[model samples]
Target: GWTYGLNGELRKATRISGIEDFSINVFRRDFGLVPIKVATWGPFVLLNMDNEILQKDNIDTDNVASEWLGSSSELFSLNGVDTTLTYVCRREYIIECNWKVFCDNYLDGGYHVPFAHKGLASGLSLDSYTTSIFEKVSIQSAEGGSKEKEDDRLGSKAFYAFIYPNFMINRYGPWMDTNLAIPLGPRKCLVVFDYFLEASFKDDKAFIERSLADSEKVQMEDIRLCEGVQKGIESPAYSTGRYAPNVEKAMHHFHCLLYDNLIN
Candidate 1:
């Protein structure tokens, strides 16, 4: 079961003339529900702004805008309106997987893409891997299977990119951007996926369907494999795992960072 709440009546009381006023009231109210899980995904909340009713009046759509735009709560009054406003809380829950493990597997692509996801990476032929690191971040790219030339022929082929801390940018022929393995808990995670593409990709519905199917297959593979690995990690049989030279460098880098932070 999933849940959320929006005290519309409460929102109306805090109404002020501008965003600044709304921020003082609506944005500050401490809603009681503690978030056990959260993920950076689209539509966490959406407020329709720049619309007719809103634009005609000198209304400060800030309170509503803030909530949709990253404001944690709703506590403002409409700028030009005199009546009370209310909101409906929205939320949904699905599946069983922990946060940390999901993050680890998501960040560490070395284990599965080549093996479990042969369907997707088969052509990529990733024998070894390499990484680029920053002060507190790193980006890992898999070694070859398909030639860069072939990718060009495909018009826009797929490639994997990992942005440290918890962001993944998967470029599937200029059509997809999915943030896989966002932590929801120590054992649960949320995979956020979005699709975009060149006009060519969109024109081919069959290709679009095939691509989406392939993506789903790869994701399902990841979920199953990560879950199994999680079970194995709890078994006492394995206390730690080693990185295969540069093959698993991302994982090693992650572990080193974790150690540096926790131990310091």
Candidate 2:
């Protein structure tokens, strides 16, 4: 059996305005009260086919068991911007690399930023960048300014959050982009970037246009870097390598998750 229901009122409070690239799986089931277990936690609704199985595991469905998902409770807040905005752009790329490789590259955080990304490197102060490990996610952020445009706006902080198994949220100023890595094959992944900005900024054509242009530049740089890494992964001389605990904590955290899940 499967279950689904979010309170009509609570749903509005949790509104994202527009979810953009966020994905959810939906299914339908007929009404039946026989031999099924249902669980409800904060913002999480779960169902299982066997009630006895849940009991045997000492699982309580009615009471909260697991912590909430994602990094925050109010992930889509507008901050200083107007709240009536919606996502306006979605850009996608198909990179010739294993999905894990793509994720590994992302998890490396700013390790390669100063070396591989000239534009991004200029914007990000490498020393000021920081990475943190959470139970189910990791974050890498920095205070930055591009050499071309040095933090012209008050909202110049660059924030990047990664949810396990290839979901990424990045915010630079009033613009936010979510990246989803979808595996296509053993060594291919489809990555999508869905961009959102403050509704008030929509009227400022120059800002929006420049933002998109700069975003494309950053994406292209990442694509090239990832592709090069994919080629390196194919080299027979290389197998696996170590990580810098101080710098690549997020990458290390992701690998731990992968190992733990595989062990199960």
Candidate 3:
């Protein structure tokens, strides 16, 4: 059974059999009657049903953006520059690596950018690259390089933000894309990419196609690096390695947070 109402008016009740608990409310019926917490920021929607997270105090979705993003919260505000963007395309990539391995590769600042992603590195000022870590977030930013053109793929600035576990939001030039990593097995994962472009550019078919192709090329480069790293980890002779203090701070932060969650 379920009830619907608008502003406490035009109320209606629908009855259904086998529903033993009406008090158990959740946002998705597919998950049964378990309680689900939802929060929205601009065009982003976050849903959580983990009891471990729900048990914590002050879990309000409204405060999540501010708390996790800190000073960067303004970038996602409804009245901000993001408002000019509209969803354009989505892509999925199946990678032969653990979910955490993908995250580690992303959080390694820009250490591997120059060596493994030559095309991508050419558009960014690696010397000026910076990484900032917060309680539950890490941000890496860089300025366009000297060779960047007026209509460059990455524009004049780039920001890559990682939200804890397995989510990433990348904003570069006039484009924005989100990456959601889902684990399929011990060494397999799926990464979903949703791209958005400035509303004004949505009608430019050639531009959109060129942008997507460039993005796919970079992703393919990353996939090779991640898969190789996973294979190395599985080697019997593989032992613990040291992190590059200046470049791998965010990766270290991720490992620490993952350890805390697993042990607790």
Candidate 4:
């Protein structure tokens, strides 16, 4: 076993006699260790293979979450996310579009929610939806449209936070889910969904089932919109488009970050 420093240098190395000897002998030559930087935020683990990038950017992984979240950091704790939640299940969706397209759809505030997610919109107050962009994160929040009910799936408030470049965290009601977009090719991506719920609700089978179903419906709707946007972008008729100044600020921020990364 070995421990490494943030700079990707070996800090300590140890071996268990017999077991380690057998494993070492299995390889014709002694094992060469590759250094990697790892950090953990709650249950999520982050890994970086190239420590030079961190040194070049002067980044501290210890504060990455708070730096990205900025003023909205409190909301995560207030909602009991990452702390008092129990992971329930995971779902994966393959989308026929660039990963960026899916991210763009999410960072558009709630502009498409009313039109594309009618059922979901009915539960959320679109008029109260707002977007806030931080250094490397964007948050969209909304209040529930109606008074909370015993069976309300969306509770009284919701927060959808995107951590650049390909991670999303959504907290609503007593539920939280994360989305990770991975690019497979120029026009294909895989979106992984991990669902979590407040520990108190873990035993409520009916509530869990209904909430997941509602979420699935909205995701299916977004998949269609994202796939269609990809088709439109590939068409000769579509070259460029304008951003909605108020609702699409987050999406624009995302593109700017991409541009800066590419050029730098």
RMSD of each: 13.1, 11.1, 5.2, 6.0
What does candidate 1's lDDT look like per residue over 1-264, in tens digits? 222345222333333447553542444354234322222223222234444633343334444334332331221111111122111112222325665565567566466676787655664545544455444444454434555433321222334445445555444333435364556666666666655555544566676666666666767887788788878887877887666664556666666777897889
In the predicted model 3, the residue pairs found to clash are: none
Q: Predictions ranked by TM-score, top down?
A: 4, 3, 2, 1
Model 2, position 214, has a per-residue lDDT of 76
Model 4 TM: 0.82
Question: What TM-score quantifies how close candidate 1 is to the native fold?
Answer: 0.56
Residue 221 in model 4: lDDT: 99
* Higher-ranked by lDDT: 1 or 3: 3
Q: Candidate 4 on 1-264: residue-level lDDT in tens? A: 666555545555576446645454343234435545566666577676676753454457768567546666776676656766799999999999999999999999888998999888888888999888888878889888776432277888888889889999998888889999999999999999999988889999998998999899999999999999999999999989899998998999899999999999
Residue-level lDDT of model 3, residues 1-264, one tens digit each, is 444443222233355434665323432333333456666666676676778876665467768678556666765452233556799979999999999999999999899999998888888888888888887778888888775243366888788888888989888877889999999999999999999888878998998999899999999999999999999999999999999999998899899999999999
List the global CA lDDT of all models: 0.49, 0.68, 0.81, 0.83
- On lDDT, the candidate that comes out on top is 4
In each prediction, how many residue pairs overlap at the backbone (N, C-alpha, C within less than 3 A)? 18, 0, 0, 0
lDDT of 2 by residue, 1-264 (tens): 233344211112134435655323211122222344556543224466665564564555423233333444243233222234467789889998887887887888688877777876776677888887777778787876655566533146777878777888777777767789999998889998887776768677788787788778877888888888889979998888888877889989998999999999
- Superior by lDDT: candidate 3 or candidate 4: 4
Stretches of candidate 1 off by over 4 Å are 1-95, 142-158, 260-264
Q: What is the lDDT of residue 193 in candidate 3?
A: 100
Q: Which model, 2 or 4, shows the larger TM-score? A: 4
What is the Cα-based TM-score of model 3? 0.81
